[model samples]
Target: MRQKAIPALETLMSAARTIGNPYLERAKKAGRKIVGVLYDEVPEEIISAAGAVPVLLRGTGSDGTELADPYFRELTCGYTRHTFNEILNGKWDFLDGAVIYNSCDHMRRIYDNWVRRPVSPVYSFIYAPKKGGELARRFYAEQIRDFLHRTEERFCVTLNEERLGAAIRLHNEKRRLQRELYAMQKGRRIALTGTELLLVMMAGKSLPVEDYNALLRKLIASLKSCAETFEPGVRLLYMGAHADEPLFFETLESEGGQIVVDSTGFGEQSCELDVREDADPFEALVSYYFEETPAVPRKFGTAPARAGHLLRLVKDYAVDGVIVTRLTMCDLWAFEQYMLRPVLEKQGIPSLELETDYILQNRGQLATRIQAFVESIRSSRGS
Candidate 1:
């Protein structure tokens, strides 16, 4: 059965590759509706259901914060400023419509500015609640429903509960297969590289869920049958803000480290437990927020809880060291690094922190630093 699944999985990945700006190119050529979704909101399924392609706008793949300084103040997070500048520069002019969510204060302000300033083909603000409370849930559900209503009106499409449920099921299956793949990493049976996994995860943002799941199942089966080829390496647990590229992990692998577990959304974002169709769908969304690991809106209690979560991964996977990667100007993860470093280090665990951007242009410098760190661990063990 495992061997049989491989062909299907490859096909699925092929389909996912058609999404994002790459897919937009084809959509434009063919004259299909292209909707750009802001980070982490507007599920890919929703856009698919609307007869439009959803491209996640993660901002420019550039370094050097100076490029964004003129538009946003120095205090603003780099991610926000870069995304805003991308819009100002017409980098995403091809988009037919955009869904922006108030995920953070910075994002909220960006949305406001986009509305006042004339940019993007079409735009809407999808309000997101900041707290976990009954009021917040009600507000968010209403907002999602309103957003759907507006999208339907604008695009001349109908969105019903049945369609939403189907989308939910499809996404759920994709996530299940991804979880299974991560589980294989936990046992070191697959020796899955981080770059490979990141590609798979990003593919999820735009691919048809059913097709993506099919590919993952096939990939997992292929790896299982070829388990004998897998080589043992230093088990690693990764803790970081979103990784810019998979090259960081590739470099680590070159230094004899295999990432056995990761605490970021790349590994666990889709792991939110399944939702029941019988229950109110809105309730399921709220439940998802609570059940998912590394709950967002990082408050005081959540930081220590996240650290404890990392500690468990260390023990469970026999991790040799923890690699915490922070995007240059991401304050949340920066604060997380400051807070969690001592906790992990005090346990007598070795750790390395790397600052990086979305592009791999600086791979030469990064490779040297990674090699040095890994070699130091090897020397310590030898002594």
Candidate 2:
């Protein structure tokens, strides 16, 4: 199994690198509807329960945003523009339906344009509450039920609790496998590159759950024979927005900075919690999203709590430094970095913040920053 990991990783990375996912193609071939989701906090189990596959409509690291320029203003985040560009280029025509939830102004704009243009056969925007509490949870539960009901009605299928439970279980298994893989990296028992780990996790959103789990199981079994030694690099934690593609990590690690953990929606943050099976799945699912998931936009005024989670990862992964990245116009993560950086700095965690677009436009500049960051870490350790 270990020996087979190279090809499996490549396949997953390729799926993630491409515009439409390969597993999505497989699911389509199997006569399944593929519903495209935008970002985090949108529970995909609902889609899976409705007998459809949920594929996250991630952006391509395309060179230009000319296609989306007319639809969006200049101030729109590049991530959204890049995705819209891909949509206009006929990249996501494989989707049967789309679920868009509110996370920021950029995503809302994406929803607006997407609905008017109609890439998928059906498109709906689900309201997501920005705060957490009993009132919020109750409201979110209602929203989840409404979304589920809408999906069922739109597709003319019954999403009974049994099917939902099965989907939840399958998703949980995938999360468990991911957690195990991260643990191996954390313990220095396996040498999984940050870019590779991220690709595998991103594949989970694109690949069928069962296929991802099988590949993960094989990868984990393969890592068992590996030696537990700290990999040669400046161990780092990446806190950012949607870094689905490998370019960001590749450039950052092109020098000597090795990311062991990340807080992006496409990274460790995606699998932070699991839906409960004992109680009402809807209630549990809402609770997990509202209470357990550490989304910065949703947990405003809770910097200490959020910082504590980052600190925990810092300690767990033995991270030497932190890289805080944000899409050029992503206000949520920009403000998040502002709020969290002070907390981390007080604890002596060296961090560098970079604002970039989806594409690797300024590799020379980013590589220089990464080289400096890595050297700073080494200098501080020597001191």
Candidate 3:
């Protein structure tokens, strides 16, 4: 089932690196609406069932936050700052609507500032619970149902059970293919560098489900023949926070480390679980995000579960070490690192923690630390 020298990775990554690709343009041109989503937990299957493209938005195209600086406080992390910059510049003007979630304090600023803008998408807010329990599950399901009704009424589409089932199956397939793509790296040689994989992951979310699934099928089947190249180094599990730019992963590759696996945003966290095909679609969606997937640090009482998840990944993937990176001002992930450090150490996993901004202006400094960490891992393992 493998093909020779398939030539689609570059095309897919090119589309991923930018905001709107030809596929996105084509979708818009066809009168299909694009709905922007800020969090991966935002139940995109519902968006698709409502006949819209659920774009996981990022600020890669932002040049500066001059447009954003005046409206926000200094403590808002660089991630949201650049996104606000892009918003003011009209990069995301293509969205017909947007679904915002209460991801953190920094992200809450998005809904507030975005509402005041004259030009913005019709909005729907999601309140994903920070805890796991039956009461929390009931509340989230009700919220999703409310979201569904708002989407249908706002977007003028009917979401029947059949449509919901179809959407769930399509997204579940995308999940399976994405996980399969990640599994391609479990061996000694990796098909692509961590940077390329980040772009691939980014690309997967940028396009429609069908198109992305096709690209993944081709890439997985023909990885040996893909045109891209990379050198594998110590296998490290890159962890924590939302970073859209490939510069972070590119730097890791340059420092003699291939992020063979990661727990970072747009990494393993997005694809580790799939919704049930047999259950009520809404209940399945609630269960998948609220219960099945490992709770992140932001979720209440999840530290032990998160630590166990990391430990299992290291053992499962043969990770040489772990690197925990977070934005300079992200309170949650800052605490996540502080809490998880002891767990990683108690297990004897060599690790590095870096505090960075969205701009990555301190690459030289971060790279120095990474070089030492890589050497330390090699020395300990006698590699």
Candidate 4:
């Protein structure tokens, strides 16, 4: 069936495509605090509970790293450099405060650079544990408590139990809706393209949960009624790096590859699980973020869990192969890709890992490689 015009999708794309978003501007004008989320694991619900919008900052539309070069240097990952460049260029001026956690070295550098010349009022940094255990979980809960205290103080809003619970429910609904969207793509004939899904996910990151949920409902309804079938393509699970742009997916899909599932920042990885509304909000959030949610490679002793998560996705979505794309100079994801090769191979799955920059500087070459990967996957499947 032919896809009908869904205005919600266009609205979402507009939100995803630019740092300047209408919903955010409206909220700012209405005196709503905008908290910039620099890392994936930082709980958005806490920001929402503090009566702020948790805007997941993206480094798209980067002209060059010229301005941020001196500040971050060439050693940092391109995602960090480009995003720091955007912050320097005043693109992120709308942020009242931003949460930066030490999820990786790049994030730690971002916090340091931001401190050199802080853009927003709150340049808060939180510590996330790299391992999991009873002690680790308890320690992480304390860290979350400190963050909540800071957020409440910064925003001058009391995040009482009621408000925190409400926020958890709101974000949980958003995750549920996103899962609904993904379920639409699990079939052989998909409704939305990978680029389209990324745009939608990006929209969720920017807008208020209430507004995002509404727009998402409209888009989902339209899709349920009439989502166009995708053409013959290789089903893929895209992993590694901090990929938030549609261009990366566009490059992958250009060669008969469809990214049906992804484990990248600002994508499904952040919203893979929901916090428990029944338990203490902070404890539930800590558990969800530290223990339940998909851990990035920086988290030690999590390779098996992370790999198992990917393997399940491959089976659930009927993925033909996995393409691990890491931004250049990202030591964490680089190691992650190397470690995942054996895991995927053990399951008889073919994989490819490409090192590209934040803006995909090596597009022409990357496209050639992606084409080859898709063709090889198809050949092996005898499709």
Lowest-sum lDDT 10-residue window in model 3: 1-10
Off by over 4 Å in 2: 1-5, 118-120, 226-230
Candidate 2 vs candidate 4, lDDT winner: 4
Mark the regions of model 1 whose C-alpha exceeds 4 Å error after superposition.
Answer: 1-32, 41-45, 60-69, 84-91, 117-122, 225-229, 290-293, 297-300, 360-364, 379-383
Please provide TM-scores, in order, for all candidate models, with all chains considered together. Answer: 0.81, 0.94, 0.95, 0.96
List the candidate 4 regions with Cα displacement exceeding 4 Å: 1-4
lDDT of 4 by residue, 57-81 (tens): 6687887889989876568888888
lDDT of 3 by residue, 204-308 (tens): 779988888888888786785565544466888888787877677778767788888888656677888889998988888888877887677778888888899
Clashing pairs in 3: none
Error of 1 at 53 (Å): 3.6
Query: Judged by TM-score relative to the true structure, which candidate is superior, 2 or 3?
Result: 3
Instruction: Identify the superior model by lDDT, candidate 1 or candidate 3.
Output: 3
Residues 235-320 of candidate 2 have per-residue lDDT tens digits of: 88888877765777888888877778887786787777667879777777777776777756555566777788899999998888
Show where candidate 3 strays beyond 4 Å.
Answer: 1-6, 224-231
**Candidate 4, 155: how far from true, in Å?**
1.4
